[model samples]
Target: MKKILGFAFAIALAFMASGCTMMKMGTAFIKLEPETQEAYAKMMDSIDTYGDPAKAMMIETKINDDVTNDDAVEAIKAITEERNMRVTGDVKMFTKEDAAPDEVKHARIISVCNLTTAKVFLNHSRYYGGFMPCRIMLVEYGNGDRFLITMDLTLAIKGGKPLPPEMLKAALIVKDTMETLIKNGAAGEF
Candidate 1:
């Protein structure tokens, strides 16, 4: 009976100490935007589903089997132009000569940007420059699999304290535009 009481006392002390630590951790997140929790939850879900932290932070779509790489690239370009965004850079990272016989056959990175939106974000915070000119990658593996991948923007959109109204609007526009570009581009839709 005495041993059981002593064990119970030790457990209570441990809980008390951990409770203080948990409270401190919780307070550290007080300044984050309310939506930050939801954004983090979504990211965690992605990590769980994909089993890769890098993959969780990206949005990827497999190109349709019928869609050629050139067609997909062209579709992405057309959509960017239609949406008032410019193709700032397009680099072919891997080509036949650059790869081994059993390696990636084709790999390209296309960068798109809206100058006005870019300026808006830069003016708001210089750190936003890191994300400037969003990029979409088209990669075709050796075995004939192809995919379009881009960074997922949930954390950028909601991880910090709430953005100003204008900034939020601009961010959402960029998000929607990128998502459309990837989804439609993969399907070869202009």
Candidate 2:
């Protein structure tokens, strides 16, 4: 009986050690928490100013039109409406264009969100509120230039951490919807 007890104890220690190794391996890859501001900034920085995605999950598409910045805004609006998403905000960058309107280019961002998806994500982690109301940016070197920019949903969600199964499903929904918007926005189709 004493020998059996010793064997059991040894087996338990081995299991514990294996568990610790697995935990350490997981931690070794976590450079930074995905939900932190630093992570966010890093992700954004991975993309170029012109909408080209570098090391980050942010996606960018060049606009090859000779129209105006307003075109990008309209494209966002139409796509959001078609996809049944809500337009939360439209921000104009370099509002100080008064400093030199023609000296630079035109840039703006349109924020959109679907309440259903937001609710799912929030239920999983309210902190995600920071990324709420996803954004679609329209960048034009000149008035008529075109570029479509937005976060990559898969990358953003995965970065946050392995979400609960329900949250994962919701994230995928948001991802597919966002992808549709990006494709349509880039193609200038609703």
Backbone Cα, N, C clashes tallied per candidate? 0, 2
Off by over 4 Å in 1: 1-30, 48-51, 97-103
lDDT by residue (tens digit), candidate 1, 1-190: 9999999999878887776666767876787888899888988998898788988788999999999989999999999999889999999996774555568888999999999999988998899899988999998877778899998888998998888998899889889999999999999998
Minimal lDDT window, size 10, model 2: 95-104
Model 2 C-alpha RMSD to native: 7.5
Which run of 10 residues does model 1 get worst, by summed lDDT? 94-103
Whole-model alpha-carbon lDDT for candidate 1: 0.89
RMSD of each: 5.2, 7.5
C-alpha lDDT values of all predictions: 0.89, 0.69
Task: Give lDDT: candidate 2, residue 157.
Answer: 67
The candidate maximizing TM-score is 1
- Per-residue lDDT tens digits for candidate 2, residues 90-182, read 888853333343344666778889898888878777877877889877765534445777777655566645677777776777777777766
In angstroms, the error of model 2 at 19 is: 6.5
